[model samples]
Target: MSSTTETFEQYLHNFIESDWLSAIHTLLPEIHEVDRNAVQIWFRFYPLSLFRYLQSAEDLEKAVQGFAMLGRYELKDQIDTSHHFLYGHRYWKTVKAAIEAEAVVFENDDIDLAEEIRQLAAMSAEKLKIDVSLVIAIAAVGMMTLNQTGLENFKNAADGIQKPTGLMAKSPDKIVSERSKDDSQGVFGFLKTVNKKYSIIYDEKRNDGRFAITSDQEIAGASALDRSQNWQEKDSRCWEGVIPVECLSASCGTCWIGVIAGQEKLSEVSRRERKQMKVFGYNQPEGERPFMRLSCQAKASGNATIVIPPWNGVFGKKIYQNVQDVELEPATTSARELRKVVSEAAINKAE
Candidate 1:
């Protein structure tokens, strides 16, 4: 068997986009479009740098503990389900169990990870009553779990942590169908100026997650929520709406949402949006419109679905302290003060 170190770094490196994309294509006919996007988003969100950071750590516990956002996120255990915010997460436990059983029975050191996952996916399909696509994605998660925490921890199951609801629990088909829903009858919509109305499914438990954006110009943040619902029942400060928003201007970072589907429908990520996301330590990579976005800044022109992270933090300077060339644009009073602190630290190092 490959050492845990080899297995962990192997997938992060050579597995590459093409490898997973290849799997996505092979399973396209069997997997729902939503589940396919979930795989793509999972790969994007859990970056290679994260794995390298963990792998190269002299002390794993310290590395995890010293993380800028440590304790801010509930990802202490079940390393495999780190991407659970994506769709089809409900199938993870079943898929991981089956994969573990196979690994034990074979004890094959030269195991082809991809082929092994594919075969396990096929075998679980009949019993799980779920699509092969989802099983395939979750199986990959199982492999990652094994590589990250070993089989002993993988089998223990996560305890006491409460995962997000709605999309994680729903079937892929139902999640995808949400995007096609519309209720817009606006003059511009009827005239084909824009999609009449786009539904934003944030949480699907009892329809608390779904909302209609009738106006093409409306941003999917606090303002939109207020327009759609009566905020009188609860304080609109935060978590009062389907998508929480502390500052509708993207300064607070509370409105960031992961694009589960329909990312193309959302407006392009602005320079300001990119800056805020970086300072918020949500997503630091550069892309025209990343899977991670500030809901206060993204306006939808078509149907879309998104996942609201259970937590948010402003730790960009700490997280990307070593990253060079990327200039950070500070927002809000607190973030600007944070910049000053970082600047002082840099000056101290130079001295």
Candidate 2:
């Protein structure tokens, strides 16, 4: 039920990372870019480093001490649907049960993780008549759920969701094909406006969740969101954009998104954007085109797919830089203690 055991420590060696996730693209070139990118985005959404570090720590309480604002508990609640954006999401219920059964064998170190994934992927593909590549991605999602919530809680989710929601009903091929469509040839196009129109899928949950962009104005993607009447109902105080944008500049970090597919379609990160991402503690602010990006600063060049994180905050630098200070020595720190520690830290900082 807990990760503070030898089996989990051993399993950590074969753990998946961005490198391995990226290599899957080469291994399964037939896999649609949407499925591939969704897997990667899922990894970014639930960072493995954070999982491994906490599970392996001598004291779980101290490990989670200052990360209160990071909402570690909140993430585990959605572990099951984390990969809902993947093409084969419909097969998650079957996939999860398979993983739960295998998790016990993993604890005994009787089977290798990769071999199990391949076998599960093959069986699920055959049973559901879906692609094994997609199954493999969903299997990784199962493993992620187990890793964070532990086996007991993982098994507790047996009933599973009744079905896939929203945009999931759309064919993946349709979403992929829509990327090539360009609507820049209207009257606006003739008037030297709306140049090189591109489609951007922001909320994969909804089939209608997208907007258009043109090369004419070098405006960022969030700014472009406001231009589209096609988006969902409007909101107040945030420029009526689907994606929340406060500063319009990257300073607020409210409009960040994970570029699930078509990373190359977006312009490279600007100096200001990179600095703000790290300051907000998004993704260590690494690389020119890291998957994590500030939507307000990212300008679309061609069609792209992105997922807006459920929440945003400015705790990256403050929390990560000072994590070591809060680590304590206990494997059983209750959630209340976690909150108290963070609350006290806040009070001290205020003083």
Candidate 3:
């Protein structure tokens, strides 16, 4: 298994085996009070998130309401109100234990005991995803109650993982597959059958496109394109004056392409590809899977269609920096001239 897949599986296994299970079990009495269907749906997508929150929660009412908030209000209304009351009651039981054990402290020690009951009612706001915005909102509420600077530290922490775009979107695999199929048929109809069986597709019409492999295939020798001399002529279209490749190694990202279809079908990512893709800036977010890859590095055993990027260039970092500088350049000519003079002076001093 690829390290990425192995790491994910290990994470899941560790969570299952650790104190997380004990924490969830402790929540059973409270969880039972929630609408059975709502609880089931919430657990499906957010078992880990809920478990983590429960283990850390300062109060029981807040903990129970937190999980309930994961479900939409419209759906919650469909369930029995008795279930909701029971859910709240059970959650508070755990919260009272946490407070008694000194796991979480309240800002106002003097507040009447009834305030704790009211706090649970306030926690039913239905924003899920537990993203930066949610974290910021929680901090804001804490600051309002505590009259302190806790929100600033929380904001700084959230900023580290925030994306340039607010949306946490992933590329659709089916769309990629369809594009690969269209491109392959348009360029190399005769090679379709062979290309389908293997993960890589070669198109001579585009930049002398050579072999394209799926992300997961194990390459023999140096790279995926490397083949024995006997099979080289028969397997490689470049040998038949079809698609030409200058270098078979990653030195040339020439074989870069968008995964047309079946990204899941491709091999799980490797350490080398992960590093190289970052260097190339093809994969921007740390959490995202790369959509483009070097064909020579990626090997596919199953069917996948791919579309080649128009051009390949090394020195990706320099290109990215230059683009950013230009975009941020001052609008006035005077500012531009001053910037240019300062840049020249810095260069001369370095030399």
Candidate 4:
């Protein structure tokens, strides 16, 4: 395994491996207070959506590349966050099915298949209560192990309850969160004391974690753009350590960000922001606040952890293909039945 893969593995491990019910209560006390079940259910299946796209990869190396690509693009556009909230059990079953489909179980004389099954049964029996997040992590780790090694190796590792450690973090490839350490000690440090500023942690590869904005300030992406202006002046299109921003007024979809934490503390999504998000095809109007939000539209009221996408494009209305209209023949059926038939006919015609 490469250092890049190892670093990401550790990051993923730290991000999802937790006693989530307690963790959510700690990090998002308000959310847990109002609806503890909702928060707990959401975090339980968080690993499912996080690891779902990786099922398509043919090998461990490709899976790492897929992970990196996911940081850049919204790959699973069809599966929104609400699906997990409403149908977590079904969603998790599907994820497990995908993983099992990709995984290969050995059936050789040297490997006791029955014993392996019994061990797996014992493990499941031990944790009968729904700690779904840990179960998913275990399966995900097993899949990664199978990819790097063979099925027999995975069985052995699983039997011994040993996590597969393919690669170790190296000095040159250490994933560090970049923070502005000089902010409090500079000549302009006094200016920061005037207002209540909150830190925004960019949780992507760049890990640009030092951008701070005053209370009720414009989104974190804008702050990042201001901080990186010198670099932008050097190269107008540079986005090395900056959150990509084209039109800061929420016109372009270039500044969409995923709120990994502190979402509730952020200012409410405005009417214009909601409309623009729908136009950008990044959000649905089903909820007041969503995990996926336009950074330009979302103001930071407190510290937030956000993930920036790799690329952006305008596809609001363009995502839909042209549809042909159809005239239904008059029938003796009731109006409701006729309308249903017409709808079915139109769908069939579209197909």
Candidate 5:
């Protein structure tokens, strides 16, 4: 076996030997609280090999990139060509299925198979191409801290503790100043603190709805336009799929915008959003601007605005489905049903 593979096997051994597995399992009751039976079933066939594979990668960067490639290929193969897999939900389901199927297995008795499984997990992580370590870390911590609670309570706890951003600190001045003076009369309280630090603007003509874009000053003149309108019309040439949005909720990743300039003006990160973003491969360390937010989730306080990201995707689920479809080509009934649902949804939405 390669040195990298060996190292990952060792890491997996250490993880299982350490309290991590038991801790995770204990927390599983809390983590899978929402669907105890389902989660229990899933745990029965957890892909230890995939995890070990991820642990084996040279570094987190390689692991993430490899995971992304694997995920894309897998998705292409598994999902029915005619069906569309909603990104997040489908990918997760595929992972669960892979585990259940023991397709990526680690023989509990064989040390070599264990090592191989570690390598596979690392490969899977690389395909994801995002910081899976962060998610794992978050999950670890969550399990450790909130394992006693039920899934719903655990989720609520996560929501409560998840910081909006790493930059925010507890300060009375910062806290009080951020809120509006007129708390009773204004819908502007959320924007108060945010606007003072960043220039905010409303775009009505484009999406036929209100959305904010980050200003050039806040974005440090990264592009030619200092204002949101100019950025949208003249400066937003680099982006594709830039369009108006109807729903601001997670219902549509359509309003998925990027922080070309001021990412710091947005609110603190939430666990759910963070997980979702990672699954979509949008979170980056260097590009960690406060401005990188979904316009709908990002409420403007003062004058914060932002440019759109270059691409928008709804394939978290599709990627995994692609892989499964390829493996089970002869038994295409499930694939057909998925494709039909996706096609119908797409048609309905387009209409």
Candidate 6:
């Protein structure tokens, strides 16, 4: 590598700065064509702004919801329009834990910290494959910002390894597979009208394949909510790519989503969606079409891939206040404990 490149990698030691992402970019120097598209999607996770909210969130679920709302109500001139939402939501807990483990390992006298980090990254790549870079990148972000106790908590969360499920991800694999079939005709070939379908792959797990969008319905309208409700009504099998929904009129934030691809083809963010998105703390007055959109409001115009957040809420200005509270906490405090305090405070308010 050139002297400038070596210097840049050295600067990456302080992973807090948004500029540190450039080092991550350098890691993927030679890309295969098949992996090219995935690389672009991964690139979206950098520059920190795209995912600063990830740190602000108290838990994996809130972090997922926050990013989903941001994507659903994407502004035309939004500042952080990146695909970090994809990998961040999926592997955040694991990666956060791994980083905390790194911190604990940092305290060890015999371990080679740099070598250990590389080994962790390599192992992550071997295991998670598609999402390893994202995992390492986000781990870098946490290492830069978290204090020792917070790191311990993060490590604890990772060690626990009990993954949280996002509302949009409650789709049944069998139904998704049945729907994904090339159904040029009915189950018995009696129906002959071939529907114009588009593909939408959820969760970034490519082996899982794409969910067939048989119509131009918004993701919420076309999702597993329909099948879930049907199952409730009758003993029917639930379908896949289902996002949580209530009121479907942009009244609830449950159906919020982040578009990782094909944002241009989705309908423009309507005025009502924009208003709700802001009320939900999903968007700022930066621009329109900021990659975040309500799955209900955003009618897919073509094929796309999206990431569903784990939870949703209606905090409005209070969301900003909550963020402020997190920021004000002493760096040495355990993040897990702070989250518990926040959760308790919220519950007390409800009571």
Top-scoring candidate (TM-score): 2
Tens-digit per-residue lDDT, 214-240, candidate 1:
545445452345445664344333444
Comparison by lDDT, 2 against 3, better one? 2
Q: Taking the tens digit of each residue's C-alpha lDDT, what string does model 2 give over 97-117?
A: 776655545454545555555
Return the clash pairs for model 1, or none.
203-209
Question: What is the lDDT of every predicted structure here?
Answer: 0.57, 0.58, 0.32, 0.41, 0.32, 0.44
Per-model TM-score on C-alpha atoms: 0.67, 0.69, 0.28, 0.42, 0.26, 0.46
lDDT of 5 by residue, 130-223 (tens): 3332123222222222222222332232121222221123232342233222122246645553323333322211232123234222122222
RMSD of each: 6.0, 8.4, 21.6, 15.8, 18.0, 13.2
Give the runs in model 6 whose Cα sits over 4 Å from its true position.
1-136, 141-149, 157-195, 206-210, 224-241, 284-286, 321-351
The ten-residue window of minimal lDDT in model 2 covers 323-332
Task: Return model 5's CA RMSD, one decimal.
Answer: 18.0
| Candidate 4, superposed: residue stretches over 4 Å from native | 1-132, 135-194, 204-208, 220-222, 225-241, 318-351
Predicted candidate 4 versus true structure: per-residue lDDT over 129-148, tens digit per residue: 53333233223323333333
- The global Cα lDDT (0 to 1) of model 3 is 0.32
Clash count of each predicted structure:
1, 2, 10, 1, 62, 21
User: Which model is ahead, 2 or 5, in terms of lDDT?
Assistant: 2
Let me know the TM-score candidate 6 reaches against the reference structure. Answer: 0.46
The model with the greatest lDDT is 2
Q: Between candidates 1 and 5, which one is better according to lDDT?
A: 1
Q: Scored by Cα lDDT, where does model 6 land?
A: 0.44
